[model samples]
Every structure is written in C-alpha cells, then in structure tokens.
Target: MDFDPLPDKPAPDNPSGKLVLLRHGETEWSRAGKHTGLTDVPLTPHGEELARNAGPLLSGYDFVLELCSPLERARRTAELAGLHPEIDPLLVEWDYGGYEGRTTKEIRKELGYNWTPFTHGVIRGENSPGETVEEVAGRASRVLTRVLPAMAEGDVAIVAHGHLLRILTSVFLRMAPRFGAALTLDAGSISVLAFYREEPAILTWNHGPGLPLKPSES
Candidate 1:
C-alpha cells in the first residue's frame, strides 16, 4: 500500500498521434507494490472508483481500438472506461515466476537473490518460462507491430500493467527493454505517447487520476 513518489517529472509535450496508455486500477498486489505479473487478480474497491472516474477523464479521445490484457484488472479498467477491449495476451505484465505475490525486498533476503527482469532473468515459477528482459521487450514489440497499422486513423487505448507498458514504451522509442526500467508508471495512471516524424515522444507518464490535477488539465 506504499509507493515512492515519481522519481522525476514527465516528458515535455510533442506533436504525434496520441496513444493513450492506461495502467489498470490498483490490486492488493499493486497496492502493496508487489509484482502482479500474470496473476489475474481483481481490483480493490478503491481501484474500481478510480477506474470508473477515468471514463470522464478520457471521454474526449476518439479511440478506435481498445487493446487490453486478458487479466481481470485491465479488462475491468477498460470496461469501466466505457470501452470493450479486445484481449491481447502480449499486453499482460512480465511473468514474475517465483516472485509472484512476494515483494522484492522479501524475496531478496529470503533467497539472497537479486534479479531484475531487465537484467537478470525471472526464474521458474508462475508457469512462466522465466523470460528475460529482452524476451519481454520482444513481446512488447510484437504488440506495437499489431497496433501500428491502426495508429494512423484514430487514437488507440492500451490497458495494461506498469512494467509491460514501460517495456512497450521502450520498444516504441527503439530503446532496449532495460531502458524501460528507468521509466516508472503508477497504478491507475494514464500515459500518452506518440510519434513525430517517426521519432518517439512521450507526452505524459505516471499521471495519477486521484491527484489534484486531472489528465485533461495536465
């Protein structure tokens, strides 16, 4: 139920077809800041309220397609946002494997293991193949490829998780997946990313709806 404030400010505004990225509402795992990759947990009560409010916040955008992870949190968020998302497995979070349901600190001390999907690979657990950061990034890139053809027409809304979304951003920016580790997105937050002359530009990141400034105002 604790998270550090955003480490730094969001990127400056730029001109590009808007790609609205929404992280799903909070889960017990997310509220506790534990990795919820592929866990399929439902949203907490507070999370539902936030997701419902997002409908008005994002009503202005002309989203032609709603691509979402099959996980309950994301699908519920998309539904609350007044859109029906076509489930995309690639949109799911990184597989946490043995780390699922456990905090990073707890796992670190318990196993004396310090592994990051961006650097060290996820070990066997959660029925995941223990995918590495590069592998995860490739999956994200495939999603981008699926979405690009539709990008030229209307805005696209991606309802997904924090780490996976960050990885998707890296793929869009043509950066390695490890670079995404530096980009921190909050739970129930919205991010806008787009391209100018084929160059990636991040219009926003880690924006909280419950914060005084709404997404439209920001």
Candidate 2:
C-alpha cells in the first residue's frame, strides 16, 4: 500500500496505504439510466439495503480518512455503511447540465447521434450548466491532493457518484481523463486502489456484496 503521489512529483521510498472507492447506491435516476448531478436525490429502499450489506466488506479496514459527497445519496450510503464520513464537494457527481434527468438513449434521440459524456462532453441549459471532463478532473486532482497526505497514515475511504469516481480512478493512475470512459462502476460496488512495487494499481474493482473474495496473487 502506498499513498498517491502528486502529479509531476517523485514517489517516496517507502509508502503504505490503500484507497477504497465506493459508489453510492441506487436512486430513481440511476436505476433509470439518467444523468444525475446536483439533483440531491435520495437512495431507494433496495439501494439502502445494498449499502448496509456493504458494511461487512468495508468493516475489515480502519480508515484514516472517510469522505463522502455532500449530496444526500452519497452521504446516505456512507451512513448506511456505518461510516462517519466528512462531506467533500470534490466527491460530487459530474454535472450533466441539459442532459440531467435524461438517458443516453433519450439524448441521442434528441440530438440525432450517439452521444456520450466522455467524448461529447455536456451543454449548459436553462436549468443545469454542465461541466467539462477537465473541470471534473481538476476537482479529482484536488481530492487526491487532500487525501494522499492522509493515506500516509492509513487506509482512506470515499463514497461518491459513479462518473466522478471513474474520473478519480483515471486521475489516480495518471491516465487521461477520457480514459474514465473505460471504467464502469455500478451502484453500491467497491474498488480498491493501492501500490504495486511503487506503482499505482487497482487491487480490486466493481466488487459487490456476496461476491467471493479472490485470493490476492503472491
């Protein structure tokens, strides 16, 4: 385990830490495949159950820092998981803007093309003014800056939205923000980021409750 190194900074000689990334449980928009950002939605009953079930998987680790999005859904998930987490604005979901509350299919139908947030980005509207991938990445970087120092002390946990966490994962690996398109995080799933021989690596990803834990490779 190693703390996240700053971009353009040299790695420390000896480092030990792990980042546990948790996506908040389901909401109506999430279940309906809508782009949810800044709506302050709550978790569904099943979603709360999912988060509660995740407690066992997370209980094994003693986290030095526990952070959750300021939004209700993420905070609620953290509560259900039995973790007292500080609210972090950086953990907020990507702003979908005009696309908010709309599915990709619905967007495609309106725009007459196969559009995605990763490439096409988003547009501002009367209701929601969207954000660029770079903007979200900037927030993610700030989060890393704050969390990396804490990581030196012990494991850290983050409960947030799907798109934001994927972007954060890309930032963690020093990959281009667009690379976030390749990572898919389901609601209530967990992913672990740690060091492998001084390099960042994803130890486990998209793990849900009741799934068998595979033995780590020697």
Candidate 3:
C-alpha cells in the first residue's frame, strides 16, 4: 500500500488529479424509485455494506477536497466509506418540492401525461419550494468553483445523491444541465471525470464493485 500522493499534480505525465464522484448507496426512497430530496432519509442495511466496500476504490488517492451532502443518507455513506467529507449544501439532491416522496410514474398517472423533473418541473411543497434546472445548475457551478481548483493539488471526492451529481457532471462537461437525463447513475456507483487535452471528459462512468477502475487515461 506504499504510494506517492501524486504531489506533482501538474506533472507532464499526469496533468491533474481526477474528480471522483461517489453517489450515496441506496436509500428506502431511492430503492423505491421515488424522487428523494430535502427529506433526510437513512440508508438501508445493504446500503451501508455497499458504502463499506466502496471505500477501497478511493483509498489509493489523497483527496485535496472531500465534500458530502448534509442529508443523512449521504452523510452515513461518507462516514462508512471513511471519506471524512465536509458538509456541502450545494451537493444535496435536487429539491423535488411537492414530489418529495412520490414516483415519476405516479405523478404522470395523476397528471394524465408523461412528465419528468427536468421537463414537467415541480410545484411548491411543504418542505421545499422546488428548484428549476437552471437553479440546480447554478449550485453545481458553485461546487465546481471550489472543486476544480483543488484538482491542481490532488484528487477531489464528493459523496452525494444522484441527480445532483449528474447535473454537476453535465455542467463540468459544458453540456446543458438537462443532459443529465442521459446519464444513469446507480446507487453505490463510482464515476471519474478529468481533463482530456484541456477539455473536461469522463474517464469512467457508473463503475461498481466487481468491475475495473483502472487509472484514468485522460
């Protein structure tokens, strides 16, 4: 387990450390395919185990910055994974407003038409007033502002929920925030993003245990 921390962050061979994203393991609502936001839910037992195993994937690096959503599920996952991340409100899941505890299927059935958070939007709810995709993207931008600079020092880690991470990824890649819909991130999954010839690129996507996570070729 002897290794260098890659102190030469900008060495010719390795231009900068990668941005590693660790999506929190499954929660009751997430497992049920419900829109989870604002509400702080705990992880299922299996989710705890998943987070334990996910630790090793990130063990090799010394992250200059580690951030996690304040929600219990995300915080629990970060603790289990030994991330010791700072609480980042910007990393919280997208505020689903009135849809907090409901599923897209149910909402669409009730509305009598197809709908999605990115397309149909959400209504004001008791817990949250709902946020537009643009608003979500703005938060993602703020996160990047702090994280991207840290990359020059070493890798940065983020332990958070799904939709927020995907939206952040889109913003990092200079894609429209709605592009997040095309990216599927599963609970307990790991993803890596870094620069490719001066442009942001995805080095790995939706990686999980029993899978390969070789060094980024970026």
- Candidate 1 residues 1-218, lDDT tens each? 01112113222333334788998887777777677888788988877877887777688888877899998999999898787889998888888787777777776687677745566656788476656777677788778765665667668899988888988887777666778878877667889887765567788887767743222100
The sequence of per-residue lDDT tens digits that candidate 3 reaches over residues 32-129 is 77888888889888788778888998888879899999999999998998889899888888888998889888899999998888777788998679
lDDT of 2 by residue, 124-158 (tens): 96786888988888889889877777777888999
> Clashing pairs in model 2?
1-16, 1-17, 2-17
Give the least accurate 10-residue stretch of model 1, judged by summed lDDT: 1-10
True lDDT of residue 61, candidate 3 = 83
Cα error, candidate 1, residue 104 (Å): 0.7
The per-candidate count of clashes, in order, stands at: 2, 3, 0
Looking at candidate 3, what is the lDDT of residue 58? Answer: 85
Whole-model lDDT, candidate 2? 0.83
What do the candidate models score in CA lDDT, each in turn? 0.74, 0.83, 0.81
Rank order by TM-score, top first? 2, 3, 1
lDDT score for residue 130 of model 1:
55
Q: List runs of model 1 lying over 4 Å from the truth.
A: 1-16, 111-115, 211-218
Better of 2 and 3 by lDDT: 2
Model 3 scores a C-alpha lDDT of 0.81
